[model samples]
Target: MAVASNYLLDTGPLSILCSFPLNASPYIYAILQYTKITLADSVIIEAGRGKIWRIVSPLFKTGEIESTTTPKEPEILDLSYGNDLGLGERSTIKSAMQMGLTAIIDDRDAFVVANRFAVHPIGFQDWMVMLSREVNLPTKMAIEIVRSSANQFPKMFLAHILKLLSE
Candidate 1:
């Protein structure tokens, strides 16, 4: 059997995945069940004593989740200079490129950087659409999850999601 494509998440996507209200956003859970979800150790450090880890720790404990570290890629970070962003975004993008995995990043600068490196970058709204389509999540429930998490999403992205939900 063919393995599914792996998705490497940054702090933003990981936080959103773990932030859904209890009992809602089952699509998030379903996606986790179906995909090889990974997080860079830098992202975990950035999440830092938050609810994201609390809700997802059981999965990690059960070996359903995986974490990795990118060491240091000075060349990649050097290319990202003058962007005025931190190393976390740089590292996330670099790690994804190095591993040839899709990356989930919500920050605009980070998204741009990832795109520049030719690494596919997706945001929360993209996840909503993807999860809905790939896992057969009900459109209504996916919309609700996107709407409820709108505040955590970029405005442009939220608008696009609303449009998709409306259609």
Candidate 2:
């Protein structure tokens, strides 16, 4: 497996990115590696419908995001604990681990599993921070939108980042 110095997006983050309609934008560009974000093959197929496809399909044609499949070799990252993760999440994490890449996933169970293996997991809240702070989005709006969406993400995690963003 090739080492991915890019953020590997999972289905959840991809969906939320598509769904978040901010200023007539899909809001996916806030991801720092937006130009380099990739989707596992399964995730691409999974996200190949609805709002996500509309936003990301053009990017695929423009070569902004890449589509990759699970490697046959270099099957790293023990999957025993990732049973709760869906196929896309599992492959995303596994692929990230093998390639030493950070995974952009939003599932709580997947986060816990990624933590056990020391793989960097960037969830929705983290994306907000990246948007407001790193990506230089409107901090106030990013915080409000992200904080209010706590029900869709991890509340505590969202609170932590919001606090940090406020500081």
| Tens digit per residue, CA lDDT, model 2, 1-167 | 12224678889878877776567666675542423587888787777677788788888888877778776433344346435567787778777877777788888788777777677898767766765565565677777667546678644677688787887
lDDT of 1 by residue, 1-167 (tens): 22356788887777777777636543346556556788777777788876776766777797667887875765746555636655557767878977887888888887887777788898868876876667665677778778877888656777778677666
lDDT winner? 1
Q: Which ten residues in a row have the lowest lDDT in candidate 2?
A: 73-82
For residue 159, give model 1's deviation from the true position in Å.
Answer: 4.4
RMSD of each: 3.1, 4.5
Clashes of 2: 0
TM-score of 2: 0.77
* Candidate 1 segments whose C-alpha is farther than 4 A from its true place: 1-4, 22-30, 78-83, 165-167
